[model samples]
Target: MKDLLTTTSSIIVILFCCCVLFLGDDADQHLSEPDSEMITARNHKKFLKARHPLAKTTLFRRVQSVRLKDGVLMFVTADQNGLKEHFFIIRDKNVILVKKDAGDMPPDSIKFDADGHGGIQVTIPNTFELDPLQDLLSCRN
Candidate 1:
């Protein structure tokens, strides 16, 4: 009985050591590297330019507000000429321009004004129309 107990204990210890050696602290390192596929999948400008005829004219607009609502991300923006734009992320990689009657207007938001040479300014409600990117990095739980 003693010999059998010792043999089983030794086997278990060896298996644990092998697992520790094989798995060698790579989980954290893998997470630290920025995922290229995710970045490429999120290339919003490329997707927008492909869909819209006036995409070239609108792509230059700066980001305005990025907020999260009930796990969904909302992005609000303003163009160089003070046009307001609203965008939202429905899934991991999908972003869509929201319609005017979609929901309530975003709260007091900041946007870049071209007249001020890209200086940030407070935007008025529903003035000029534009689309923006959701601030996913800052929206972490």
Candidate 2:
């Protein structure tokens, strides 16, 4: 009976030690991750401050173009003061608009037709000819 009791106590202690060791390792791994993330954020802030003094300055930047499939659906190269920098589209059926900070300054040869609401649409030839160089199928901007 004494031998049995000794064996049981040894097994219990072994299991308790294993659990403590594994839990300690997991805790250490998790503890290092947050510290690295905090260090990275701190370093990026220091780099930005040293490189660009006016990085935090605020300035007005207005939307000027809404394009769909290489087609200039809307064009506003320049906006007048007090005239809205952004216009809301009430309806854009079958249209995916892209916002461009550079505005609609396409080559002069690509003519635009009035689509109303300060927007222009690219006119395609009625013959249905495709430009071999132009591939506007991708959904990504």
Q: What is the Cα-based lDDT of residue 40 in candidate 2?
A: 68
Best by lDDT: 1
TM-score per model over all chains: 0.22, 0.30
- Candidate 2, residues 16-40, lDDT tens digits: the string is 9999999999999999987666436
Top TM-score prediction, candidate number: 2
lDDT of each: 0.47, 0.44
Per-prediction count of colliding residue pairs?
A: 5, 0
Ten-residue region with minimum lDDT total, candidate 1 = 112-121
lDDT, candidate 1, 13-88, per-residue tens:
9999988876776765677676534436658666545534322212223456555554454565576677565643
- True-vs-predicted CA distance for residue 121, candidate 1, Å: 39
**Colliding pairs, model 1:** 83-128, 84-128, 84-129, 84-130, 85-130
